[model samples]
Target: MRIVIAEDAVLLRAGLVRLLTEAGHEVVADVDTAEGLLKAVEQHEPDFALVDVRLPPTFTDEGIRAAVLVRSQHPRIAVLVLSQYVEERYAAELIASRRDGLGYLLKDRVADVDQFLESVGTVGAGGTVLDPEVVSQLLVRSRHRQDLELLSPREHEVLGLMAQGLSNASIAANLFLTESSVEKHIRSVFTKLGLAHEDGGNRRVRAVLRYLGYPDPGPGHPSSAHPSHQEFRP
Candidate 1:
């Protein structure tokens, strides 16, 4: 797969290039600044990009903004972000857009080279991969809802898979269940969460997003389980 990398750190940037290059994948462009990163993306049009959360000019969310811009302008480009910390707000911004092919992970995940490559491949294939840490944080924030507390452990596992943006088949494969059973579990989950919506094509994704308090607020859009009038703080 062809890739563009946007990271501020010199060592990590070089290491990622070496790793991808050694693994037989092409690293089309590796740049330090967010502007240069976007330029490289525009010029080379790589299949996927691995971006860091922080970059030059302002070491605060410059790369994140660029990634969002890429997703908006080039809907086809898969983008994975590696950040020092998992911010629910950032995840909400990414998921708010209707398109897929997105990932947000903690920086430490880089230590597991093989697994990291696997995630890169998954997102590049139009899948969404969220860090388990991010998932946990979202869940904790959503726990105030009595409906969420009612989910059985197995059903909760299904919800997590849904949040990762996996389809029924993929979730079934991951959970070692038949696709039919996964569908059944999903139906039950929607019922339990009181999130039944025929218009929302991907109810599972919407459910997970709502459960995480990032509803779309449209016909099929997610409604706030937690209202927008409320402010969530760290």
Candidate 2:
């Protein structure tokens, strides 16, 4: 895949560039600021962009805003943002606006080079991927928590695996279920979540996002930090 990387930390940026390049993916542009990210996207029109959630100047939501802009402007450019924390509202906002070819992963996930590359490929191929921590944190703030309560414990587990971009086979293996059983549980999740009309891979992602609170952020919702967010990050 051809890619652009926007990260403020010099060493991390360099490491990413080296890693992607060594893995035989093109690094079209590597920049440190959110504005630079936009400029790079407009210039290169790379297949995907790996961005940090925070970038130069304010270091708060810059990369995310730029990512949203890129998605709006060039709908074809896949974007996967790496974050230092499990940013709750912005993550949901980004996903709610455009779920396809999008992802939010904690930086530590990058340490698992093979899996990180797989995530890059997944998002670039127009799939959604969220780090497990992001899903867990987002669930705590779910505006539809009661809706989530409608799921059976098994269905809940299935949807959680779905949120992590796991396939039915993978989810089955993880949960020690047969693939057919996994599919049944997934369908139940969709029906209970009222995503029956959502359809195909889209519904699965939609259901996972909905169950995990990736909808429009409610104004009444607290903007305070979620306790789970603090527990996971290094």
> What residue pairs are clashing in model 1?
216-222
Q: Write the per-residue lDDT of candidate 2 for residues 184-218, one digit (tens) a residue.
A: 99888878767645254456555655665655222
**Residue ranges of candidate 2 with Cα displaced over 4 Å:** 143-234
lDDT of 1 by residue, 166-224 (tens): 77888899999999999888888888866657645545555666566653353443343
lDDT of each: 0.81, 0.83
Model 1's TM-score against the true structure: 0.61
Best by lDDT: 2
* Candidate 1 local lDDT, residue 207: 63
RMSD list, candidates in order: 15.5, 15.8
Q: Per-candidate TM vs. native?
A: 0.61, 0.63
For model 2, give the 10-residue run with minimal summed lDDT. Answer: 225-234
Model 1: residue 157 alpha-carbon error in angstroms: 36
